[model samples]
Target: MKVINHIREVRQRKGITQIKLAEDLQVTRQTINAIEKNKYNPSLELSLKLAEYLDVPFTSLFYLDKSEENAE
Candidate 1:
């Protein structure tokens, strides 16, 4: 399975920078970058914190699929 994260787009829509989001979530900018790139999946607590910070539903931030080609 593959997971996709819409963090960058959401942050852009909210007019927030990655640094700002990282600060709000108490994580590093690299962590946010990794999440956006699908290189790292956030923990449950981190996912909830991101959802709260972005003011979006958890489903809006992340998605799961069975195919790598269809994941994006």
Candidate 2:
């Protein structure tokens, strides 16, 4: 499934860099980069934490591709 996220845009709007966000999450900048690039999927707990950190609702932050749903 495609892990679509608005994190990059939102983070940019919030004036937060990947390095800063990673520090807040106690992870590495590469980890945040992976998530933003869709090379990695964060755990459910991490997803929630991300939403909390970005001040956005979870549903707003992450979503599965509707095309994937149609394939099911």
State which candidate has the highest TM-score.
2
| Regions of model 2 farther than 4 Å from truth | 68-72
Please, what is the TM-score per model?
0.88, 0.90
RMSD, one per candidate, in order: 2.8, 1.5
The sequence of per-residue lDDT tens digits that candidate 1 reaches over residues 1-72 is: 778889899999989998998898889999999998999989999999898888999997888865866755
User: What lDDT score belongs to each candidate, Candidate 1 first?
Assistant: 0.89, 0.93
- Give the distance in Å from residue 29's predicted Cα in candidate 2 to where it truly belongs: 0.4
Cα deviation of 7 in candidate 1 (Å)?
0.8
> What lDDT score goes with residue 33 in model 2?
96
**CA error at residue 8 for candidate 2, angstroms:** 0.4
